[model samples]
Target: MNASDRTPADLLSSALAADPGRPLVTFYDDATGERVELSVATFANWVAKTANLLQDELSVEPGDRVALLLPAHWQTAVWLLACASVGVIADVAGDPAAADVAVSGPEPESLQAARACSGARIALALRPLGGRFPQVPEGFTDYAVEVPGQGDRFVPYAPVDPEEPGLIVAGREFSGAEVVERARAEAPELGLTGPGARILSALPYDTWEGLNAGLYGPLATDGSVVLCRNLDRLPGETVDQRIETERVTATAR
Candidate 1:
Protein backbone atom coordinates (compact mmCIF):
# COMPACT_ATOMS: atom_id res chain seq x y z
CA MET A 1 0.00 0.00 0.00
CA ASN A 2 1.09 3.56 -0.70
CA ALA A 3 1.66 6.11 2.03
CA SER A 4 -0.87 8.48 0.49
CA ASP A 5 -3.43 5.72 0.31
CA ARG A 6 -3.32 4.71 3.97
CA THR A 7 -3.07 6.08 7.50
CA PRO A 8 -1.28 4.62 10.47
CA ALA A 9 -4.62 3.32 11.72
CA ASP A 10 -5.06 1.46 8.47
CA LEU A 11 -1.73 -0.21 9.02
CA LEU A 12 -2.68 -1.46 12.46
CA SER A 13 -6.11 -2.53 11.27
CA SER A 14 -4.63 -4.51 8.45
CA ALA A 15 -2.08 -6.18 10.68
CA LEU A 16 -4.80 -7.21 13.10
CA ALA A 17 -6.97 -8.51 10.31
CA ALA A 18 -4.14 -10.46 8.81
CA ASP A 19 -2.98 -12.11 11.98
CA PRO A 20 -4.76 -11.08 15.13
CA GLY A 21 -3.35 -13.98 17.09
CA ARG A 22 0.24 -13.63 15.97
CA PRO A 23 2.75 -12.05 18.30
CA LEU A 24 3.42 -8.45 17.32
CA VAL A 25 5.97 -7.70 19.97
CA THR A 26 8.08 -9.66 22.41
CA PHE A 27 10.04 -7.77 25.07
CA TYR A 28 12.70 -9.40 27.19
CA ASP A 29 13.45 -7.75 30.51
CA ASP A 30 17.18 -8.10 30.99
CA ALA A 31 17.01 -7.31 34.72
CA THR A 32 14.90 -10.31 35.67
CA GLY A 33 15.19 -12.11 32.33
CA GLU A 34 11.45 -12.18 31.93
CA ARG A 35 9.61 -12.19 28.59
CA VAL A 36 6.43 -10.34 27.68
CA GLU A 37 4.58 -10.76 24.42
CA LEU A 38 1.74 -8.91 22.74
CA SER A 39 -0.36 -10.35 19.97
CA VAL A 40 -1.61 -8.21 17.11
CA ALA A 41 -5.06 -7.89 18.67
CA THR A 42 -3.64 -6.84 22.01
CA PHE A 43 -1.19 -4.41 20.44
CA ALA A 44 -3.92 -2.81 18.38
CA ASN A 45 -6.09 -2.32 21.43
CA TRP A 46 -3.22 -0.91 23.46
CA VAL A 47 -2.37 1.59 20.76
CA ALA A 48 -5.97 2.67 20.58
CA LYS A 49 -6.15 3.15 24.32
CA THR A 50 -2.85 4.95 24.52
CA ALA A 51 -3.77 7.22 21.64
CA ASN A 52 -7.01 8.12 23.35
CA LEU A 53 -5.25 9.02 26.56
CA LEU A 54 -2.68 11.14 24.76
CA GLN A 55 -5.21 12.95 22.63
CA ASP A 56 -8.14 13.37 25.00
CA GLU A 57 -6.61 13.62 28.46
CA LEU A 58 -3.17 15.04 27.63
CA SER A 59 -4.59 17.54 25.15
CA VAL A 60 -2.10 16.51 22.51
CA GLU A 61 -3.17 17.79 19.12
CA PRO A 62 -2.27 16.79 15.58
CA GLY A 63 1.15 18.10 14.63
CA ASP A 64 1.96 18.59 18.29
CA ARG A 65 5.37 17.13 19.13
CA VAL A 66 5.84 14.41 21.78
CA ALA A 67 9.27 13.04 22.52
CA LEU A 68 10.05 9.55 23.74
CA LEU A 69 13.11 8.85 25.90
CA LEU A 70 12.28 5.18 26.39
CA PRO A 71 14.54 2.26 25.77
CA ALA A 72 14.05 -0.30 22.97
CA HIS A 73 11.08 -2.02 24.56
CA TRP A 74 7.47 -2.93 23.76
CA GLN A 75 6.17 0.17 25.57
CA THR A 76 8.26 2.27 23.25
CA ALA A 77 6.60 0.54 20.32
CA VAL A 78 3.19 1.21 21.90
CA TRP A 79 3.99 4.90 22.36
CA LEU A 80 5.17 5.26 18.77
CA LEU A 81 2.00 3.80 17.32
CA ALA A 82 -0.15 5.68 19.81
CA CYS A 83 1.32 8.97 18.69
CA ALA A 84 0.89 7.99 15.06
CA SER A 85 -2.75 7.08 15.56
CA VAL A 86 -3.61 10.57 16.82
CA GLY A 87 -1.54 12.43 14.23
CA VAL A 88 0.79 13.67 16.94
CA ILE A 89 4.28 14.36 15.70
CA ALA A 90 6.52 11.84 17.42
CA ASP A 91 9.95 13.28 18.12
CA VAL A 92 12.51 10.54 18.60
CA ALA A 93 15.36 12.55 19.93
CA GLY A 94 18.52 10.76 20.96
CA ASP A 95 19.35 13.44 23.49
CA PRO A 96 16.66 14.73 25.79
CA ALA A 97 18.02 18.24 25.31
CA ALA A 98 16.39 18.07 21.88
CA ALA A 99 13.04 16.69 23.01
CA ASP A 100 9.77 18.06 24.39
CA VAL A 101 8.83 15.03 26.50
CA ALA A 102 11.18 12.38 27.79
CA VAL A 103 10.37 8.73 28.56
CA SER A 104 13.32 7.77 30.69
CA GLY A 105 14.96 4.46 31.45
CA PRO A 106 17.38 3.60 34.25
CA GLU A 107 20.20 5.58 32.67
CA PRO A 108 21.02 8.57 34.87
CA GLU A 109 22.52 10.50 31.98
CA SER A 110 19.25 10.28 30.06
CA LEU A 111 17.29 11.21 33.18
CA GLN A 112 19.57 14.15 33.89
CA ALA A 113 19.43 15.39 30.31
CA ALA A 114 15.68 15.03 30.28
CA ARG A 115 15.46 17.26 33.34
CA ALA A 116 17.78 19.84 31.78
CA CYS A 117 16.19 19.83 28.34
CA SER A 118 14.88 23.29 27.57
CA GLY A 119 11.60 22.52 25.81
CA ALA A 120 10.55 19.50 27.85
CA ARG A 121 7.09 19.56 29.40
CA ILE A 122 6.48 15.98 30.59
CA ALA A 123 8.78 13.26 31.88
CA LEU A 124 7.79 9.56 31.89
CA ALA A 125 9.89 7.12 33.85
CA LEU A 126 9.25 3.41 34.00
CA ARG A 127 8.57 1.81 37.40
CA PRO A 128 11.83 -0.10 37.40
CA LEU A 129 13.67 3.21 37.60
CA GLY A 130 12.47 3.63 41.18
CA GLY A 131 11.13 7.10 40.30
CA ARG A 132 14.66 8.46 40.18
CA PHE A 133 14.13 10.76 37.21
CA PRO A 134 16.01 13.93 37.96
CA GLN A 135 13.68 16.53 39.45
CA VAL A 136 12.23 18.57 36.60
CA PRO A 137 13.61 21.78 38.00
CA GLU A 138 10.94 24.45 38.17
CA GLY A 139 8.43 24.97 35.32
CA PHE A 140 8.03 21.36 34.19
CA THR A 141 5.57 18.61 34.90
CA ASP A 142 6.80 15.31 36.22
CA TYR A 143 4.51 12.74 34.69
CA ALA A 144 6.09 9.81 36.44
CA VAL A 145 2.81 9.04 38.13
CA GLU A 146 0.41 11.42 36.42
CA VAL A 147 -0.36 9.54 33.23
CA PRO A 148 -4.02 8.66 32.75
CA GLY A 149 -5.37 5.14 32.37
CA GLN A 150 -5.73 3.82 28.85
CA GLY A 151 -9.00 4.64 27.14
CA ASP A 152 -11.05 2.28 24.96
CA ARG A 153 -10.62 4.03 21.65
CA PHE A 154 -8.74 6.82 19.90
CA VAL A 155 -10.32 9.60 17.91
CA PRO A 156 -7.72 11.18 15.67
CA TYR A 157 -7.43 14.95 15.86
CA ALA A 158 -7.12 15.25 12.10
CA PRO A 159 -6.45 13.30 8.94
CA VAL A 160 -2.88 12.26 8.43
CA ASP A 161 -1.22 13.93 5.46
CA PRO A 162 1.63 12.00 3.96
CA GLU A 163 3.59 15.17 3.37
CA GLU A 164 3.34 16.26 6.96
CA PRO A 165 6.29 15.49 9.19
CA GLY A 166 5.75 12.34 11.24
CA LEU A 167 8.96 12.18 13.24
CA ILE A 168 11.88 14.44 14.12
CA VAL A 169 15.37 13.14 14.80
CA ALA A 170 18.15 15.28 16.18
CA GLY A 171 21.69 14.89 14.96
CA ARG A 172 24.89 16.25 16.37
CA GLU A 173 24.56 19.62 14.65
CA PHE A 174 21.17 19.49 12.96
CA SER A 175 17.79 17.77 13.02
CA GLY A 176 16.14 15.90 10.18
CA ALA A 177 12.46 15.46 9.40
CA GLU A 178 11.33 12.02 8.28
CA VAL A 179 7.95 12.52 6.75
CA VAL A 180 5.65 10.13 4.92
CA GLU A 181 7.29 11.51 1.82
CA ARG A 182 10.38 9.49 2.59
CA ALA A 183 8.31 6.53 3.67
CA ARG A 184 6.52 6.50 0.35
CA ALA A 185 9.73 7.02 -1.53
CA GLU A 186 11.28 3.98 0.06
CA ALA A 187 8.43 1.50 0.68
CA PRO A 188 7.81 -0.04 -2.72
CA GLU A 189 11.24 -1.39 -3.54
CA LEU A 190 11.95 -2.49 0.03
CA GLY A 191 9.34 -5.28 -0.04
CA LEU A 192 8.29 -4.13 3.46
CA THR A 193 5.17 -6.31 3.59
CA GLY A 194 3.29 -9.63 3.58
CA PRO A 195 2.43 -12.63 5.77
CA GLY A 196 5.26 -14.45 7.53
CA ALA A 197 7.39 -11.31 7.14
CA ARG A 198 9.13 -10.26 10.32
CA ILE A 199 11.67 -7.56 11.20
CA LEU A 200 14.24 -7.67 13.95
CA SER A 201 15.59 -4.34 15.10
CA ALA A 202 17.84 -3.55 18.02
CA LEU A 203 18.44 0.12 17.31
CA PRO A 204 17.33 2.74 19.81
CA TYR A 205 13.84 4.11 19.14
CA ASP A 206 15.06 7.70 19.34
CA THR A 207 16.65 7.60 15.92
CA TRP A 208 14.64 8.42 12.79
CA GLU A 209 16.55 5.77 10.90
CA GLY A 210 15.45 3.21 13.44
CA LEU A 211 11.83 4.40 13.64
CA ASN A 212 11.32 4.57 9.90
CA ALA A 213 13.52 1.76 8.74
CA GLY A 214 12.63 -0.53 11.59
CA LEU A 215 9.19 0.11 13.05
CA TYR A 216 7.01 2.10 10.62
CA GLY A 217 8.52 0.58 7.55
CA PRO A 218 7.49 -2.91 8.53
CA LEU A 219 4.07 -1.81 9.76
CA ALA A 220 3.45 0.27 6.68
CA THR A 221 3.71 -2.89 4.68
CA ASP A 222 2.05 -5.58 6.84
CA GLY A 223 4.81 -6.93 8.99
CA SER A 224 5.74 -7.12 12.67
CA VAL A 225 8.82 -5.88 14.51
CA VAL A 226 10.96 -7.86 16.94
CA LEU A 227 12.91 -5.58 19.26
CA CYS A 228 16.09 -6.60 21.06
CA ARG A 229 18.12 -4.75 23.65
CA ASN A 230 21.43 -4.76 21.80
CA LEU A 231 22.77 -6.75 18.85
CA ASP A 232 26.30 -5.39 18.74
CA ARG A 233 28.02 -7.70 21.19
CA LEU A 234 25.86 -10.81 20.84
CA PRO A 235 27.72 -13.90 19.76
CA GLY A 236 26.97 -15.20 16.27
CA GLU A 237 25.29 -18.28 17.73
CA THR A 238 23.08 -16.17 19.98
CA VAL A 239 22.07 -14.02 17.03
CA ASP A 240 21.07 -17.09 15.08
CA GLN A 241 19.17 -18.39 18.06
CA ARG A 242 17.14 -15.16 18.30
CA ILE A 243 16.33 -15.25 14.62
CA GLU A 244 15.21 -18.85 14.81
CA THR A 245 13.23 -18.31 18.00
CA GLU A 246 11.45 -15.25 16.69
CA ARG A 247 11.23 -16.34 13.03
CA VAL A 248 12.71 -13.00 12.06
CA THR A 249 13.01 -12.61 8.29
CA ALA A 250 14.96 -9.37 8.14
CA THR A 251 17.00 -7.02 10.30
CA ALA A 252 17.70 -3.29 10.23
CA ARG A 253 20.82 -1.90 11.86
Candidate 2:
Protein backbone atom coordinates (compact mmCIF):
# COMPACT_ATOMS: atom_id res chain seq x y z
CA MET A 1 0.00 0.00 0.00
CA ASN A 2 1.17 3.52 -0.70
CA ALA A 3 1.42 5.58 2.46
CA SER A 4 0.83 8.68 0.37
CA ASP A 5 -2.60 7.54 -0.73
CA ARG A 6 -4.93 10.16 0.73
CA THR A 7 -8.04 8.91 -1.07
CA PRO A 8 -9.43 5.78 -2.67
CA ALA A 9 -8.68 7.26 -6.06
CA ASP A 10 -5.04 7.57 -5.06
CA LEU A 11 -4.96 3.92 -4.09
CA LEU A 12 -6.18 2.98 -7.58
CA SER A 13 -3.62 5.25 -9.18
CA SER A 14 -0.88 3.68 -7.12
CA ALA A 15 -1.99 0.22 -8.17
CA LEU A 16 -1.93 1.28 -11.79
CA ALA A 17 1.54 2.71 -11.37
CA ALA A 18 2.90 -0.30 -9.51
CA ASP A 19 1.75 -2.96 -11.96
CA PRO A 20 -0.62 -2.19 -14.77
CA GLY A 21 -0.68 -5.79 -16.04
CA ARG A 22 -1.22 -7.52 -12.70
CA PRO A 23 -4.58 -9.07 -12.02
CA LEU A 24 -6.71 -6.76 -9.95
CA VAL A 25 -10.25 -8.09 -9.78
CA THR A 26 -11.16 -11.64 -10.81
CA PHE A 27 -14.91 -12.04 -10.66
CA TYR A 28 -17.08 -15.14 -10.61
CA ASP A 29 -20.78 -15.71 -10.80
CA ASP A 30 -21.45 -19.22 -9.60
CA ALA A 31 -25.08 -18.95 -10.58
CA THR A 32 -24.15 -18.30 -14.17
CA GLY A 33 -20.86 -20.17 -14.38
CA GLU A 34 -19.08 -17.03 -15.46
CA ARG A 35 -15.54 -15.98 -14.72
CA VAL A 36 -14.03 -12.66 -15.78
CA GLU A 37 -10.66 -11.24 -14.88
CA LEU A 38 -9.37 -7.69 -15.16
CA SER A 39 -5.85 -6.41 -14.80
CA VAL A 40 -5.09 -3.15 -13.01
CA ALA A 41 -4.89 -1.23 -16.27
CA THR A 42 -8.13 -2.67 -17.56
CA PHE A 43 -9.94 -1.97 -14.33
CA ALA A 44 -8.59 1.56 -14.23
CA ASN A 45 -9.74 2.10 -17.79
CA TRP A 46 -13.24 0.99 -16.88
CA VAL A 47 -13.20 3.33 -13.91
CA ALA A 48 -12.07 6.19 -16.14
CA LYS A 49 -14.83 5.62 -18.65
CA THR A 50 -17.47 5.29 -16.01
CA ALA A 51 -16.23 8.38 -14.23
CA ASN A 52 -16.41 10.28 -17.49
CA LEU A 53 -19.97 9.10 -17.92
CA LEU A 54 -20.87 10.31 -14.45
CA GLN A 55 -19.19 13.67 -14.90
CA ASP A 56 -19.74 14.58 -18.56
CA GLU A 57 -22.94 12.82 -19.52
CA LEU A 58 -24.66 12.78 -16.17
CA SER A 59 -23.17 16.07 -14.95
CA VAL A 60 -22.30 14.65 -11.56
CA GLU A 61 -20.41 17.21 -9.50
CA PRO A 62 -18.29 16.86 -6.43
CA GLY A 63 -20.28 16.12 -3.26
CA ASP A 64 -23.24 14.82 -5.24
CA ARG A 65 -24.82 11.58 -4.02
CA VAL A 66 -24.97 8.42 -6.16
CA ALA A 67 -27.13 5.58 -4.95
CA LEU A 68 -25.47 2.31 -5.94
CA LEU A 69 -28.01 -0.49 -5.92
CA LEU A 70 -25.62 -3.09 -7.30
CA PRO A 71 -24.29 -6.34 -5.94
CA ALA A 72 -20.69 -7.36 -5.27
CA HIS A 73 -19.83 -7.67 -8.93
CA TRP A 74 -17.01 -6.31 -11.07
CA GLN A 75 -19.15 -3.47 -12.39
CA THR A 76 -20.04 -2.52 -8.83
CA ALA A 77 -16.34 -2.29 -8.05
CA VAL A 78 -15.88 -0.09 -11.11
CA TRP A 79 -18.68 2.21 -9.97
CA LEU A 80 -17.16 2.58 -6.51
CA LEU A 81 -13.83 3.67 -7.95
CA ALA A 82 -15.53 5.90 -10.48
CA CYS A 83 -17.33 7.68 -7.67
CA ALA A 84 -14.01 8.21 -5.95
CA SER A 85 -12.41 9.61 -9.10
CA VAL A 86 -15.32 12.01 -9.65
CA GLY A 87 -15.44 13.06 -6.00
CA VAL A 88 -19.02 11.95 -5.52
CA ILE A 89 -20.50 10.10 -2.58
CA ALA A 90 -21.32 6.45 -3.28
CA ASP A 91 -24.27 5.31 -1.23
CA VAL A 92 -24.52 1.54 -1.26
CA ALA A 93 -28.13 0.43 -1.47
CA GLY A 94 -29.19 3.91 -0.43
CA ASP A 95 -32.58 5.49 -0.83
CA PRO A 96 -33.11 6.47 -4.44
CA ALA A 97 -35.40 9.41 -3.76
CA ALA A 98 -32.64 11.07 -1.76
CA ALA A 99 -29.91 10.52 -4.33
CA ASP A 100 -28.88 12.82 -7.16
CA VAL A 101 -28.20 9.74 -9.30
CA ALA A 102 -28.97 6.05 -8.97
CA VAL A 103 -27.38 2.95 -10.51
CA SER A 104 -29.15 -0.37 -10.24
CA GLY A 105 -28.50 -3.96 -11.11
CA PRO A 106 -30.94 -5.88 -13.26
CA GLU A 107 -32.45 -7.57 -10.24
CA PRO A 108 -36.12 -6.86 -9.67
CA GLU A 109 -35.73 -5.36 -6.22
CA SER A 110 -32.93 -3.07 -7.30
CA LEU A 111 -34.71 -2.06 -10.48
CA GLN A 112 -37.85 -1.31 -8.49
CA ALA A 113 -35.87 0.82 -6.09
CA ALA A 114 -34.23 2.69 -8.95
CA ARG A 115 -37.60 3.80 -10.25
CA ALA A 116 -37.83 6.15 -7.28
CA CYS A 117 -34.90 8.16 -8.59
CA SER A 118 -36.13 11.25 -10.36
CA GLY A 119 -32.68 12.32 -11.51
CA ALA A 120 -30.25 10.32 -13.59
CA ARG A 121 -31.00 6.60 -13.52
CA ILE A 122 -28.59 3.99 -14.88
CA ALA A 123 -29.00 0.22 -15.06
CA LEU A 124 -26.54 -2.58 -15.52
CA ALA A 125 -27.44 -5.81 -17.26
CA LEU A 126 -24.82 -7.75 -15.29
CA ARG A 127 -24.41 -10.11 -18.20
CA PRO A 128 -21.36 -12.34 -18.29
CA LEU A 129 -19.95 -10.39 -21.23
CA GLY A 130 -21.15 -6.98 -20.07
CA GLY A 131 -23.76 -6.93 -22.79
CA ARG A 132 -26.52 -4.36 -22.94
CA PHE A 133 -29.95 -5.40 -21.87
CA PRO A 134 -32.11 -6.93 -24.59
CA GLN A 135 -34.64 -4.24 -23.84
CA VAL A 136 -33.63 -1.12 -22.01
CA PRO A 137 -35.76 -0.59 -18.96
CA GLU A 138 -38.06 2.41 -18.88
CA GLY A 139 -36.73 5.66 -17.43
CA PHE A 140 -33.21 4.36 -17.21
CA THR A 141 -30.17 4.48 -19.45
CA ASP A 142 -28.20 1.32 -20.05
CA TYR A 143 -24.82 1.60 -18.39
CA ALA A 144 -23.27 -0.99 -20.68
CA VAL A 145 -24.45 0.97 -23.70
CA GLU A 146 -23.38 4.39 -22.48
CA VAL A 147 -20.19 3.63 -20.60
CA PRO A 148 -18.37 2.14 -23.58
CA GLY A 149 -18.98 5.34 -25.52
CA GLN A 150 -17.22 7.44 -22.86
CA GLY A 151 -13.59 8.41 -23.11
CA ASP A 152 -11.05 5.99 -21.68
CA ARG A 153 -9.51 8.79 -19.60
CA PHE A 154 -11.09 10.92 -16.90
CA VAL A 155 -10.21 14.18 -15.19
CA PRO A 156 -12.50 15.61 -12.57
CA TYR A 157 -13.88 19.10 -13.22
CA ALA A 158 -12.98 19.98 -9.64
CA PRO A 159 -10.34 18.60 -7.36
CA VAL A 160 -11.59 15.87 -5.04
CA ASP A 161 -11.23 16.74 -1.39
CA PRO A 162 -10.16 13.80 0.74
CA GLU A 163 -12.06 15.33 3.64
CA GLU A 164 -15.37 15.19 1.81
CA PRO A 165 -17.73 12.34 2.51
CA GLY A 166 -17.02 9.76 -0.20
CA LEU A 167 -19.10 6.78 0.80
CA ILE A 168 -22.23 5.93 2.77
CA VAL A 169 -22.62 2.28 3.74
CA ALA A 170 -25.50 1.10 5.85
CA GLY A 171 -26.30 4.72 6.74
CA ARG A 172 -22.80 5.43 8.08
CA GLU A 173 -20.70 8.03 6.28
CA PHE A 174 -16.96 7.85 5.62
CA SER A 175 -14.66 10.35 4.02
CA GLY A 176 -12.15 9.34 1.37
CA ALA A 177 -9.32 9.61 3.88
CA GLU A 178 -11.29 7.62 6.41
CA VAL A 179 -11.94 4.93 3.82
CA VAL A 180 -8.22 4.49 3.18
CA GLU A 181 -7.52 4.43 6.91
CA ARG A 182 -10.19 1.85 7.60
CA ALA A 183 -9.06 -0.32 4.72
CA ARG A 184 -5.46 -0.20 5.86
CA ALA A 185 -6.51 -1.13 9.36
CA GLU A 186 -8.63 -4.04 8.20
CA ALA A 187 -6.32 -5.37 5.51
CA PRO A 188 -4.13 -7.51 7.74
CA GLU A 189 -7.10 -8.68 9.77
CA LEU A 190 -8.46 -10.15 6.56
CA GLY A 191 -5.05 -11.68 5.79
CA LEU A 192 -3.98 -9.16 3.17
CA THR A 193 -0.51 -8.70 4.63
CA GLY A 194 1.24 -6.89 1.79
CA PRO A 195 1.42 -6.18 -1.88
CA GLY A 196 0.39 -9.00 -4.24
CA ALA A 197 -1.86 -10.47 -1.55
CA ARG A 198 -4.77 -12.24 -3.23
CA ILE A 199 -8.07 -12.47 -1.34
CA LEU A 200 -11.21 -14.41 -2.17
CA SER A 201 -14.31 -12.62 -0.90
CA ALA A 202 -17.92 -13.71 -1.22
CA LEU A 203 -19.34 -10.90 0.84
CA PRO A 204 -21.94 -8.50 -0.45
CA TYR A 205 -21.24 -4.77 -0.79
CA ASP A 206 -24.10 -3.45 1.37
CA THR A 207 -22.09 -3.29 4.63
CA TRP A 208 -18.79 -1.77 5.66
CA GLU A 209 -17.16 -5.09 6.40
CA GLY A 210 -18.32 -6.49 3.09
CA LEU A 211 -16.99 -3.47 1.26
CA ASN A 212 -13.69 -3.79 3.06
CA ALA A 213 -13.33 -7.44 2.19
CA GLY A 214 -14.53 -7.24 -1.39
CA LEU A 215 -12.97 -3.99 -2.59
CA TYR A 216 -11.25 -1.54 -0.27
CA GLY A 217 -9.08 -3.90 1.76
CA PRO A 218 -7.28 -5.28 -1.26
CA LEU A 219 -7.09 -1.94 -3.08
CA ALA A 220 -5.73 -0.17 -0.02
CA THR A 221 -3.00 -2.76 0.43
CA ASP A 222 -1.96 -3.01 -3.20
CA GLY A 223 -3.53 -6.44 -3.33
CA SER A 224 -6.12 -8.11 -5.53
CA VAL A 225 -9.50 -9.81 -5.05
CA VAL A 226 -11.30 -12.88 -6.36
CA LEU A 227 -14.86 -11.73 -5.97
CA CYS A 228 -17.61 -14.34 -5.93
CA ARG A 229 -21.33 -13.94 -6.31
CA ASN A 230 -23.73 -16.75 -5.35
CA LEU A 231 -20.85 -18.46 -3.67
CA ASP A 232 -23.25 -20.43 -1.56
CA ARG A 233 -24.46 -22.18 -4.67
CA LEU A 234 -21.05 -23.57 -5.43
CA PRO A 235 -20.02 -26.94 -4.15
CA GLY A 236 -17.38 -27.06 -1.44
CA GLU A 237 -14.97 -28.90 -3.72
CA THR A 238 -15.52 -26.39 -6.51
CA VAL A 239 -14.92 -23.50 -4.16
CA ASP A 240 -11.75 -25.13 -2.88
CA GLN A 241 -10.60 -25.72 -6.42
CA ARG A 242 -11.23 -22.09 -7.26
CA ILE A 243 -9.26 -20.92 -4.24
CA GLU A 244 -6.30 -22.97 -5.36
CA THR A 245 -6.65 -21.91 -8.96
CA GLU A 246 -6.82 -18.21 -8.14
CA ARG A 247 -3.77 -18.50 -5.87
CA VAL A 248 -5.65 -16.68 -3.18
CA THR A 249 -3.85 -16.05 0.09
CA ALA A 250 -6.90 -15.13 2.11
CA THR A 251 -10.63 -15.51 2.36
CA ALA A 252 -13.01 -12.90 3.75
CA ARG A 253 -14.56 -14.34 6.89
**Best by lDDT, which number?**
2
What lDDT tens digits, residue by residue, belong to model 1 across residues 201-251? Answer: 777766656665556667666666777765666778987898899888877
Tell me, what's the RMSD of every candidate? 4.5, 0.8
Q: In candidate 2, what are the lDDT values of residues 1-253, reduced to their tens digit?
A: 5788989999999999889999999999989999999999999999999999999999999999999999999999999999999999999999999999999999888899999988999999999878999999888999999988899988999999999999999989999999999999888899999988999999999999999999999999889999999999978998899899999999984
Candidate 2 stretches greater than 4 Å from native: none
* Per-candidate local distance difference test: 0.63, 0.94
- Model 2 weakest 10-residue run by lDDT: 1-10
Query: In model 2, what lDDT does residue 25 have?
Result: 95
Q: How accurate is candidate 2 locally (lDDT)?
A: 0.94
Residue pairs in collision within model 2:
none
